[model samples]
Target: MSRPGSPVCTPDWLALREPADHTARACDLADRLADRLGAWPGARDVVVRDLGCGTGSMGRWLAPRLARPQRWVLQDRDADLARRAAAATPVPATAVVGDLADLDTLAGTDVLVCSALLDLLTAPDVERLARLCADAGCAALLTLSVTGAVALDPVDPLDDDVTAAFDAHQRRDGLLGPDAPDVAAAAFARHGYAVHRGPSPWRLGPADAALAEEWLRGRVDAACAQEPALVGSAERFLARRLDALGAGGLHAEVGHADLLALPGTVR
Candidate 1:
C-alpha cells in the first residue's frame, strides 16, 4: 500500500536524476531476472505487468529480450508517468493509473514486476500482493530496495547512525512505511512461490559522475525527509560525498532483491 497522499512523495531529486543513469543498473537487474526464470516451459506468450512502473524503466529493459512477444502493462498512480511510459514501451504495452491496492485490476499477466516498489509498501500489503500473484500464477520480480546501509569510501562515523535512522524511517508504518526485501521474500514463500533473491547493488564512481551526483542528492533529500532530525547535517554530508566523487566516485551500496517465484511452488 502506498503512503496516504505519499504517492506523490517521490523525492524531486530522484525524479530528476534516476531515469537515465539508473538505466544500466535496471537493465542488468532485469537480465538477471530473465535468466533466472528463463522461458516458462508452458507459457507461449509472456505478459508482464510492471507494478509501480515509473516511466516504464523495467519495460524498456526487459521487453526486447523475450523470445515471445511480450505484452506489458505499466501500472502506476501517476498519469503523466503512465503516459510517458506508454509512449516509450517498445512492446505491446498499456498504462494504468491505479494504486497497488488496486492490483486486482491486474489479471492474466505471466509476470508481475515491481521494481523499487516493495520498499514503499507495508508488510501486510506485501503479503496481500504475494497471495494475489500466487492465485494468478504470475512470476514476480521485485528490485532495488534500500538495505539500510551505505558504505562510504572514507568511512564516516556518522554514516552508521544516519543510515540506521534512515532505515528505521523507511520501516516506519506511516501510511505505507517501508517493507524490506526479507519481508517480501517471506511473504512469497508463505504464498507458496519459490523465491530467488539476488542482491544487485548500484555500482557508481566518477565514471558515472552525473548519475552519482543525482543519487547523492536524492539520498540526502530522502534521508532528511524521512528523518527530519538529520536535515541540518544531510546537506553538508551530501556535499562532502559529492566532492569526494569529483576525485573518484563513491560506491553507494543500494541493496536490491530480484524475486522470481512460480505458482504452487513449495518453500
Candidate 2:
C-alpha cells in the first residue's frame, strides 16, 4: 500500500489526534479481544504486531488494557516513526523499518493490528491481508475505518456536496475508502474467521477545536481535489466552518468503525 506520492503522516498531526483516536476506539472490541486471548497473566509470549504503527499510539493505548506481559513489534514505512515507536513503547519492543514481509515478521505473530489503515487499501489488498493472517494463523484488530458518514452541526447546504466529493476522493485509484471494514469482514469470514464490528466515531466539539480545524481543512482540500468545480463553494464552506468552530458553535461526528477478526469459527 506504499504509494510513491501518498501523503506521509506527520508527527504533529498524529500527536494532535491521538487523544480523540483513543477516546473513539471501540473498548468493547478490545475487551472481547482480551477475552479471546484469555488471561495469560505473566505470560510474555503474546506477540502483537502493529502495522502502520504511527508513533506507537495503538500499543500505548491497548497494551496495558490487555493486562498481560507481551512483546510489541512495530512496523512503519517511515524509519523515524518506527524507531520512535520502538523507543517509546513501555514493553519489550522492536521496530521494523521496511516491509514486514521483507523481514518475514509475521511468522510467529499472534495478533495483527492496524488503525486508520484499511481506508487506504484496495479490496484486493484487504483480501490479501486476510488471507495472509489466515495462513499465518493470527487474529486481526483493524480499526478507525471511515464509513462515508459525516454529520456537522448547524448543517449547511454545501455539506453534502463536499462530503460526496471527499468520499469519492477517498475511493479514487481503487482504494476501499469507507467500504473497507465491510469488505474486510466478508473476506475474513470466507477464511473461517469470527468477525466483530463496532462503532468508533469521533465526536468533536469545542474541546477538539484544534483537531477539528485541521481535519476540516484537509477534508475540504480533498473534496476540491476530487472535483475541481467545487473550488468556489468549498472555499466559502471551509471558511464558514472554521468560523463556526472558532466561535465554539460547531460540532462534527465523523463516522468510523472497528473490526475484530479472530481465527476459527464464531465463539
Candidate 3:
C-alpha cells in the first residue's frame, strides 16, 4: 500500500536507480540462493515471482545469474509499472497486477522476491508474508530494505534529525521502516526459515550527483514532513549538502540490507 508521504516510486525513479540497486546488492546472497535451489528435488524448471515488481529491475538483475529456462511472474499493484516491468524483463515474464497478500497468486512459485518493499510493510503484513512463504515452502530473497543509517561526508548538524524523522515517516502507519530487516528475520525464523542478511548500502559519489541530489531531497522532504520543527534546519542542511555534492566533496552511504530466507522442510 502506498503511504501518504511515501515516494510513488515511478518508472523514472526505478530506472534511474536500477544500476545502483544492482551494484549494491550482494552477489554472494544470489550465489547462496542458487545453491539452495540446486538442492530442490526434481528437474522441473523454476517459478520465480517478483512482488512489487517495479520496472522488473530485480528480474533483470537476478535472472541471468541463475539457471536458465525460468518463468518470472512480475507482480505489482500498479498496472503501468507492471506493464513496463514486463516489457523490460530479459526473460519470459508475465505481469500480474494485484496485492502481494494474495497468496493464491504466489502458489507454485519456487521463490518469492521483492526489493525496497519490506520496510513499507507493517508488522502484521510482514508476518503474513512470512507465513505465506513458509506455508508455500518457497525461498524468499527480499532486498534493499532500509537500515535507517546514512553516512554523509562533510556532515551537517541536522543530519541526524533529518534521518530520524525520515525513518519515523517510514514507520508512520506501523511500517517497520529501518527495523524491517530484523523484524522480517524474526518473522521468518518463527516459521522455521533460515534467514541470512548482508549489508547492501548505496555508495553515492560525485559520479552519482543527480541520484544523490534526488535522494537527499526526498530525505529532507520526509524529515520536514515528519517533524515540522525541522523545516528551517532542513533547508540549510539541504543547501550545504547539495553544494558539497556538486563540488565532489560529498559522498553518502545509504544503508540497506539484503535478506535471503530458505523455508525449512515442511513437516
Candidate 1 residue lDDT tens string, 60-116: 766775656578888888877777778889988888888777767346877888667
Residues 84-148, model 2: lDDT tens digits: 99998888999886543343436788889989989988888888888888888889999899999
Instruction: Judging by lDDT against the true structure, name the best candidate.
Output: 2
**Measured by TM-score, how close is model 2 to the native structure?**
0.94
Whole-model Cα lDDT of every candidate shown, in order: 0.68, 0.88, 0.87
Q: Each candidate's TM vs. the true structure?
A: 0.82, 0.94, 0.95
Candidate 3 residues lying further than 4 Å off, grouped into runs, are 1-7
Question: At residue 242, what lDDT does model 1 achieve?
Answer: 78
Arrange candidates by lDDT, descending. Answer: 2, 3, 1
Best by TM-score: 3
